[model samples]
Target chain A: MYKKILLATDGSKHSIRSAEHAIYLADSFDSVIELVYVVGGEKSKEDVLHSVDKYEVKREREEKLRPIQEQLENAGLQYNSHLLHGEPGPTIVKFANENAFDLVVVGSRGLNNLQTMILGSVSHKVAKRVSCPVLIVK
Target chain B: MKLQNLKQDWFGNIKGDILSGIVVALALIPEAIAFSIIAGVDPMVGLYASFSIAVIIAFVGGRPGMISGATGAMALLMVTLVADYGLQYLFAATILTGVIQILFGVFKLASVMKFVPRSVMVGFVNALAILIFTSQLQHFEGEGWIMYGLVALTLAIIYILPKFTKAVPSTLVAIIVVTAIAIFGNIGVRTVGDLGELSQQLPVFLIPSIPFNLETLMIIFPYSLALAIVGLLESLLTANIVDDMTDTESNKNKESRGQGIANVVTGFFGGMAGCAMIGQSVINVKSGGRGRLSALVAGTFLMFLIMVLGGVVAQIPMAALAGVMIMVSISTFDWSSLRNLHKLPKTDAAVMLITVITVVATHDLSKGVLAGVLISAIFFAAKISKVKVNEIVALEGKKKVYKVHGQIFFASVNDLLDKFNFNDKVKEVEIDLSNSHLWDDSAIGALDKIEMKFEQNGIKVTYSGLNEESKHLKKRIGGLSKASGH
Candidate 1:
């Protein structure tokens, strides 16, 4: 029943699969997909103070999203892209709460299951704390 | 790299360290005697070890608060040594044990500390506490209610002394005040002098004349090995504890080597084997000790106290020392964690209980640890063996998906082999690694076997939903083709 689905991408290997899953679900539900990339505050702050070049980072972020944008367009889905400067999990949850997205999908690197359970993964945190149901693609 | 910068930082840290060392020295005086007696060595040898080891470790050790000296773990190990071989042979064994520890550290084997299970550590600490408590109960007997009163008073003083005063160590104050009152009141209590004559000289280096006796060496070797392991474990653990408290890091290998050196020297100097003392280290940290200077000061203070104040200090009652040990034991027992163990997994609880029971009943720390580790490993193996393989045939297409449900290890290799269908009409076998996570060498070997078998049968096996880690399994099996070119 999701009308607008938000997929968080980190450019990690697993995040690509998460994007694919989000696209497939969006197509099945006839929903609009939003691709959001959150550049961590530590990264953005460093870029802003000229500690590192800004255009270099901006170009890298765009290059990461290019394939996923093309996939969404080829699937004929209503897609929009946004970039935010913040921490990953909390930033995603804040975006979801503010935007009224029906679903959120994320990925995990699947280490020790026991350790993951004790110290929750990012997806597990979103699932536990967020008001909406969050899917964790491992 | 700059000399002035280096000097400024070293001196800056040293000022804070020396203050902490004074408090540590005060606490060490009583503990050194008590721990030495527990090891069945003369009380003075304990003092000698504490002095020498502390000074040496101050210069060579990696962690700031890790005060190396005679500890209860080494004391327990020394019991078997003293019982089997006389003091001379025990000394020889301790020296050799030190050499072994040094080799272990030099070989960079300190990382093996991580292999010690959490449950085993909890069991070891709790069991040692019980052992210490029981040992003190012997001294408390036949001395009337005054003995109990003294112990209670000492504990009370130790507890309240810290709250009112920070200038003097609570334990030292408790001992001194209790000893002075006991002597003046002529309280018929057992004193340290009652044990034996206190040696006034520094521990002299002498060759142990055990005469090349293989039988005696064979008997003491096992005990020495246990001592070495316990010494290594306790020292490393104490170093880590101090590191956490002081917000600093220790080069574990360096610390272990320093411990090895301390023990070897202690043995030569007529002292029993020793290790890093967690209680003293914590006391040092709490008392404002900040660097190597404090440890060196403590060592110096201990040597001076033994040589000049030996007669006066020896007049302190054994019951008072027992009381101190009893307090130390209770503090180290981790009763809250023991109670919380019941809330843990049944296997963990079982391992912990087994370790504690074995350690206390057999009085062997190494056996208890070994028992706990073995049980934990078996429990892990059993859990991994429960994973099974399932095959699903999707009706939507002729897609034949083979799901590896359980872990594929040497133990469960046959199950995986038996589940696969090698007959004709099988288009492609999709090995699902989505639910499978853990892999061991045996499991990888099993996968290799399956790959060889499948290749011989002309069956194509493609892995689906393989996570980054489990993909390593495909590499081991020599059967992975990347799903995407990127």
Candidate 2:
């Protein structure tokens, strides 16, 4: 039933699992997967400090998405990827809502209640804010 | 198109802007007062400058959500001028600072920010934190146990209350609670009123009471120039930080112009010049500020607080304000820099340390940054000033062929010259530059000297494999022998 699927990945194992779920749904529904990766403020600042060359920072960021891109290409699926900057949860929510994605998929580590209360899980924020149905893979 | 962007900038996130604006306003008070004390001016001067700058910058600034106000860096620059010539001359100097900054924007000097290395930025921020911390120490002099107790209580509320909720800024909570304790409990401590007189009256426009002549310009020009440079540097850097934090781009040239405008207006209002405050901007962003309205609200709310609750603010103990500033200084510092000292390159570490020490010692932020930049440039030049010569014998050791590698610029020309032997026993000397590039007139001069020396030694010198650009430069200088294309 979905024509456009939004998948947010950060190259973690949980996100890899979430990518599989997205691929299966896209295969069945003939959907176009809109892949997104966000660079947070702290992470971006650290990258700038660690890498003296601008191109090195760009290459490092692109390397994070290589595995997912390889997987998407192996499936022979139609997709477009975007690199965005901001807080991960809010950036993804804003993009998905603004672009009117049919569904949103994210991965969660399923932290304990106390930890989530203090640290604020990104998937929790994304699921709550996005207008479309969310698939939170653990 | 313009209207839509303006609407988005001002009204994109109303609830977030209003709430964060109030938070920023609450944080601005102690900072304004402290910076005033540093500059040897009354507390109201800094307050009025903060109010005007924030409100004006909200409208004209290129970066929304960035907070601009009276800052310690700018105040530190004003100390000598205020001490020597009084407040009127300081006001005139502020106006001139604005004009100079506007000219800088017109000339598009913001492009120079790229030359500032990341290490220097880290050092600047750490130095600022140190300065703020040192400024707080003056409040603890000859104080009783009650002052220490109140400060500790303020710190406790600031650090602990945020764990349960962040709906209200913990800094605001700490200030309110501590103020209540100091007033109701009859605790004896130094209040803000004890620092200087604070009137609830609005700032009125007044020309600086000074002669408008060349003598006046001579008096204020140097101070104004220093203030302008420091103010623009701090503001532009803060703009970059905000741009990164919010994942947005800002027009830095426009920000320069906006800062100039704000300072000019603030001067007429009998206030000192100021710039963007990194601590306040970070607080605004973390509190969900995302639009121009946040800064506008911060300015207006500060004025509102002064007018409506001036009496209560006056009764606030200096201990509470010092505690808040200490917290700000702690957060402003880059603690990880210390941890990463071993991981960073030795040159970068040295540059950062030098920048920090220079700033802390001289109380001059711009000079520290400049020193860091100059040192890093020298280090870079030294690193790249290598010109290697590879010698080969093609004619049974009778003819020596030298292959040059690496860039030949002013720094490397001497190294290049030193690599060649004028008394070589060969009949012919061939210098091959296929792998090297000539960058400046110095490289050409070195080539000429090498050829002259070889000729004088009864050896014929010929250059081969000159790239088109270098060949063109050689032809222009007419200094070197012919280069046969290889």
Candidate 3:
């Protein structure tokens, strides 16, 4: 039985679906979910440049996590949310591996072949690197 | 914990580091030679600087995987120094530049980078690209059609070869193919050898042959200051870029000190001072470099290439180097800046444009950056210098009540005074300053003037909201001219 579930979300539609799967798993097994959101370095750089007020940047990041946190709260599931910095795939992998998560739930990206080859898909990287069972939901 | 961090930073990705290091080393050659020519020194000076700086930085640099080498910005600052006083004086200046950079690191001045607006950063980059592009143009002048044809061929290969295979950097392939064509086809054209002498001899440690006196210090101080500023600016900016690419943070103060050490050693080694190279670092990261080993391999491999293939490298056509440099400039430029200029705030756009124009006009990178920072500061002050005085009409009273808002400083004192109607037939004036903070003596002086004017009109004045600090300041100063009377 999974004791600890790591759920990585970018607040995308695919991630929302993955979060639902995580919620179902946590409900069945009574696993504590560790909800994680990674702020990509590029995005943070853009935030610093665009936001005139520093609080606006913090507000925007929290805004991205509110709905996902609300879903967990409504489910009556025990969970802890974390805000991490770096590229999504590697940071998630590092955190999950360090914390020895029971399983990782991530969303499969919809990028085309060429785009994936160039920019790379974060979920693919996480699946390859993390030392845990990964559930990639579309 | 320390040992683990060292392992992660130094040897975490050995195979990838070595491979990418080779790619970065290959890319470093043309730039090293080109920057040397710009500084009006022998190609060996720049080559040795690149090798020494890279090797030294690998061991001491704050940012792992960031490649440091002879850079165009540093080279441009050295041009007049090398021309006026020759190589010896240039070496002394390089040493001085290193000393200044070390002091900057010790003072933890890297925090000043936060004050630089994003618009200024964009401008600095665009200006650098333009500067590099213009420097390459010198080779194209007075050359025949063969040079143009060779340059075109070089560009084609650099752009097209990666499609077939990326095992080797396209730049290295381009250099090899272009050199082979020029030599085998029996075409006469300018080559790297023509720019300066290249030998298999290694750089040796020696103090520059200059008189140790106050006069010598005076001669090189200006040049050294300029070089120090430009070098640190480029290196720190390049570090930020690499940090973003790798999704990691780097110690900027440590990097500053590392650059100083590298440059100081490079100066003693009969080499020019250098800093982090943006184009080469990008090549390094894109090629999978992720640890300190990559930079180490890059430095060693560059020396190996020069020592083993000195003759062949010397034969590389100037046109090929020109093509490679042109490609670097093009890639270094932020194309989006041009397209989005009209969409940016007018002040921001103007700052960006001015930074680019000043550097292009004066051939001084530091001047352009300084101008940009100054203009942005002015714009910021103008935006915040408004002291709003709004009448509180909702409050039922026969006396006038005005709420003061925004900053009260020298720039806004006139606005603060202008909002009050001095000739109004009011019995009392109540000024509320709870929301506003007084910044300086000028604000207190202005308040005193307003109170005196109201008193002359027989209107009693009352202050409703003087914060503790402002009240202390006002009491200590005792209303400017009224201090003596008190």
- Regions of model 2 farther than 4 Å from truth: A1-36, A40-60, A63-86, A89-138, B11-16, B210-219, B285-288, B480-486
Cα lDDT tens digits for candidate 1, B79-133: 8677666788878887888888899889999888767776777788888888888
Descending-TM-score candidate ranking: 2, 3, 1
Ranking under lDDT, best-scoring first?
A: 2, 3, 1
Please state the error at residue B434 of candidate 2 in Å: 3.0
lDDT of each: 0.76, 0.87, 0.86
Q: Give the range of the ten consecutive residues with the poorest summed lDDT in model 1 chain B.
A: B477-486
The reply for model 1, stretches above 4 Å from the true place, is A1-138, B2-10, B213-216, B395-399, B414-430, B433-486
Model 3 misplaced regions, further than 4 Å: A1-138, B1-4, B393-397, B483-486
| Model 1 agreement with the true structure over A13-125: per-residue lDDT tens digits | 88888988988899899999889887653343223221122355567778888887887888888999988644566678889889998999888767697666444466765
List TM-score per model, in order: 0.70, 0.86, 0.82
lDDT of 2 by residue, B41-74 (tens): 9889999999999999999998999999999888
Which residue pairs of candidate 2 clash?
none
Clashes of 3: 0
